[model samples]
Target: MPSYAYRCRGCGDTFELSRPMAEASAPATCPQGHEDTVKLLTTFGTVSRGGSGAPVAPPAASGGGCCGGGCCG
Candidate 1:
């Protein structure tokens, strides 16, 4: 699951939601019965698991390849 930011075009209200990636672009409306709402591009306040907190993988170490067998070929 991921969290996203959304804004209401009718009432100018902004909010966040934890939804599936497929539903991120679903039709959403304001609680005030305004159907003219649109999603907004906003930065997240903090990095959480549902947001930018997604983990990043690290590169593997090769222990310094081709060391000449400790003195010669």
Candidate 2:
């Protein structure tokens, strides 16, 4: 079983539920009993960074700065 985060579209309430992966998701609702809702994209606490490893953001400034002047100046 895994935990999933769901957000209510009616009252903007966020909640988490734990259930089996094969089990169908229940209709999420607001605390006011509104049935109009949706499940948000699931995210994990810690992602495995083995094998290919995690992606790293590129470093800033690729040594292309030209003395605080425009490129064509």
User: How many Å off is the CA of 73 in candidate 2?
Assistant: 36
lDDT of 1 at 46: 50
lDDT of 1 by residue, 1-73 (tens): 8877777888898877788989989887777777787787866565556656667679865445476344443
Q: Would you list the clashing residue pairs of candidate 1? A: none
Candidate 2: tens digits of C-alpha lDDT, residues 1-73: 7877777777888887677877547775556787787778965565566746666668776535666446734
Q: Local distance difference test, per candidate?
A: 0.75, 0.70
Output the TM-score of candidate 2.
0.49
Model 2, residue 39: displacement in angstroms?
0.9
Q: Which candidate achieves the best TM-score against the true structure?
A: 1
Candidate 1 stretches with Cα past 4 Å from truth are 44-73
TM-score of each: 0.51, 0.49
- lDDT (C-alpha) at residue 12 in model 2: 82
lDDT of 2 at 33: 80
Q: How many backbone clashes does candidate 1 have?
A: 0
